[model samples]
Target chain A: MGKGILVVLSGPSGAGKGTICKAFLERNKSVRLSISCTTRAPREGEVDGVNYFFTEKEEFEKMIKEDKFLEYANVYGNFYGTPKSYVEETLNSGYDIILEIDTQGALNIKESFSDGVFIFVMPPSLDELKSRIIGRGTETEETLNKRFSSAADEIKLAEKYNYAVLNDTVENAVSKIESIITAEKCKINRIKDHMDVLQEV
Target chain B: MGKGILVVLSGPSGAGKGTICKAFLERNKSVRLSISCTTRAPREGEVDGVNYFFTEKEEFEKMIKEDKFLEYANVYGNFYGTPKSYVEETLNSGYDIILEIDTQGALNIKESFSDGVFIFVMPPSLDELKSRIIGRGTETEETLNKRFSSAADEIKLAEKYNYAVLNDTVENAVSKIESIITAEKCKINRIKDHMDVLQEV
Candidate 1:
């Protein structure tokens, strides 16, 4: 075994990314979901370290100045970031880390860390996505339409991703991503140490 | 559902690649081994279409001039080559085709068909490889030593392969190669049509 893999997952709102991530974590014991640091207050029932490392705005700014975040973004006045130390520690310990992020944040991480495997999850169809968003009932007609278009934009961007895992069913998607991880670990680039040892022998 | 993958497999002698390919075909119903055209006469118990597409020397030269072969070679006055049309037709019909070639031949295919997934199989260790080769009970001491060094050279060339699957066990190597096939199919470069249709929706 070598260093752990950094898997950066991104998908649109109705793409079932969160649900799939939940199932993945439940199945793979060696993998852990990366806990994000945020200036926003945690919701009810959310654990401090488990859900998010709730941080003060000034401290978050200080972390930014210190280059402590892999990638960070401000959305609606809330600063959310992926802490650098925890991810590095987990990988150095030879445990895989899954970073669930949106497209902009994923792109930022990709630029900084080219070693991470970037995956873009997708729904089967946009029509299904529209219906799912509509089924939520919380969104008004205008917001629903906005989200539908946003999904299309995200799908277009997926062409840049290394892999596109279709979330047709949670089970199939999970298995496909699992196979991707297994295959990645066998890549020639990742097995440099193994090859070096073999060559010397 | 999509165009089939061309998997080029190569390794040193006694890597058990032949056994692994046999098991792979038994397990994967959609995949078939590619048949090459050769000027050498069919061996005892070898069928024409099943074992090889045996052709006359003139015919093989004509096909080579016609650019019908993906890669061709002359060995001990015998000509052998992978026909371009047969492989394309099989893959076009959505059946994966495996080409079992030596390191030099595999590198030639890689240069021409970048879409083809190249895999290198390896023994668990050099000592194991030496023992396996000696167990064959055919080679003299001098020839065995020559073969050992040849294997080392082949292992060095494996750095260019897309994935390296260690032949620690036939089952494990076959399973990893299957996973690699699955993962390659999910790559964004291979799913342009799916992305296009999703974008249209």
Candidate 2:
């Protein structure tokens, strides 16, 4: 079996990246969602190793010192990180892993895993992005303005991604992502081993 | 409208490149089949401009001299060439064009159009390729051996292609090609203008 693709899915907050990722996971049974390591307390029903490998702050900091995390960030005060070993094991086992992260985290992952597929989900328009953020019903006017401005800035980073998929609908976005994965598998760089075997034949 | 992709479909003689290209064109309404210009007389049912733009030998040579043909070759005394303008016009109009050519022709086109999506179709195995060639019922034992050896040599050049698709089945191969085209459209390099427009918004 071939090594699995490490897909880093990112976009602005209101671009439906989460919904698209969820739908893509639902459609593709072979792909796994990369579980993160966090120092924050688990929510009511979150399971260790499933939702996250919840750890104490000291242990998380130790892992950071060991360079065990592919990427990590301190949100507010809690630390959340993608464990490098877990991602490496999943890909080595020939199971694709999707990491839905912010643009900053995605760029950090790029440094460690240059072969990873970076995809940026795009909102149909700025106005639509505003409506989606407002539809969440939790953002204060000030926070909403701040988020909208941040999203606009993040959209500028889309050009850095290997591919940018428009989140016009969950189904369409999932299909496009599926196509990207399929095409990446067929890329010549990924098939060198297979080519060697063919040559021997 | 975004620019269309120029898909170069090539493979060994018995790799089913033609079948896959035909199936892809049948399924994708937006893609056009690139017609070749040839000095050979048209077959009984073949239509001009549809099957080929049949031209006199002098005209074909003049085109070669003028550098109007993207790639051309003399095959068994008959000249066949791909018209560069027809491909450019189709792509400029935002319609993808599928060029079903041989490996040499494809590599030649690459020198001129490096951005073209180069896809090499592969038969399941060398044995299967030989069987397929024999199945065509046109080769004698001697000619079969020659064709089979040539196919083996051609397979080695597949590494030069951007993608190598196994023609285990025509349906599957066409679907993979479809995915490749879809994914190529999402490539960041192809969407620079779209990105500029989004940034402006």
Candidate 3:
């Protein structure tokens, strides 16, 4: 059998990527979601390794120097990166890994792994996006404006990704994500590799 | 919402393309199978305009001259071609169309309608392909051998397809074909067109 695929998914804040990711995991057994490692202090009710593999800043920087991360970024004085070991372990175990990272992190990961399948999720419409953000009711008007402005910039980066999905409905979006993983598995290169093994056998 | 996608599938004899197409249509409700028109005489129990649109050779040649067929060719002294009108009518009615055509016909269709998704199905192995060809039990040993020889040449052409699915198992193969269609719908160009329309609104 051939190795599993590395699938990277990204979208703007209000695009419902998280919901679709959860739905996809519930339906598909072959996918493994990649949990990120963070150098930030854990907050209340957050586990050390569940929400994130929390690490000290010194340890994070040391690993960075040692080339242990697939991609790392500093946000608001907190360092976050995808651990290389976990990904390799899951992929080697024959489970395809799903990395629900942001656009910048997706780009960084792509820089390291050229063959990774990158997918971008989009909101059905700008007005629908605003409605979703407002529906959250956690942010102030000013903060909501910031999110909307950031969405425009993020959608532009979507053009750089390998595939783009429209989040028109939760079911539709998750179905597309699942299908992408299936299609990536059926790629000629990967299938050829399987045939090579059969030939040898 | 935009229209559904059109997929053109082709593979060598005994490659299990027919089985995959059948399973895919059973699973996906929006897909419509395209029946090709041919000048060849229908075999026993074959229904007119169902298995194929059997027509006179002169009529087929006339349609070719009129550019009515999207792709047409002469095979075994009989003309076969996809009619453009029926495909367009079904597509305009908001259904995806699957064309189970030969590699040459697929390439010809791709030339004019570049947006159609093309997939090639291959057998798990060369030995398995021979077994499948013989398993049909309809073809004589001599004819099966001829087809097996041609399968080697067809496998080479499989590289030209956008996606190559190995018909290792009917269920798994169907899942991949369904995935290809689902993933193609999530393409940025299609979503971007929707977003553009919304922006105007």
Which is the leading candidate under lDDT? Answer: 2
- Give per-residue CA lDDT, model 1, range A1-201, as digits (tens): 689999988877788887788898889978989989999877667789887899999999999999999999986468999999999999989899998887778888999889999998888888877777787676667767778778788778887789989988999988988999999988998986855436665
In terms of TM-score, the best-performing candidate is: 2
Q: Is the docking of candidate 3 incorrect, acceptable, medium or high quality?
A: acceptable
Over B91-155, each residue of candidate 1 has an lDDT whose tens digit, in order, gives 98988999887787789889999999999988888888888989876666887887888888888
Q: What is the RMSD of candidate 2?
A: 2.5
- Expressed as tens digits, the lDDT of each residue in B90-125 for candidate 3 is 877868999888777888898898878889887778
How does model 1 fare in lDDT? 0.85
Candidate 1 residue runs with Cα over 4 Å from true position: A41-45, A134-146, B39-47, B55-58, B75-78, B137-145
Model 3 local distance difference test score: 0.80
Q: Which stretches of candidate 2 lie over 4 Å from their true place?
A: A39-51, A75-78, A139-145, A195-197, B40-48, B139-143, B195-197
DockQ of candidate 1 against the true complex: 0.62
True contacts kept of each: 0.58, 0.49, 0.51
Higher-DockQ candidate among 1 and 3? 1
After TM-score superposition, the amount by which residue A61's alpha carbon in candidate 3 deviates from its true location, in angstroms, is 2.9
Off by over 4 Å in 3: A124-145, A168-171, A196-201, B26-29, B135-142, B195-201
Superposition TM-score, candidate 1 onto the true structure: 0.91
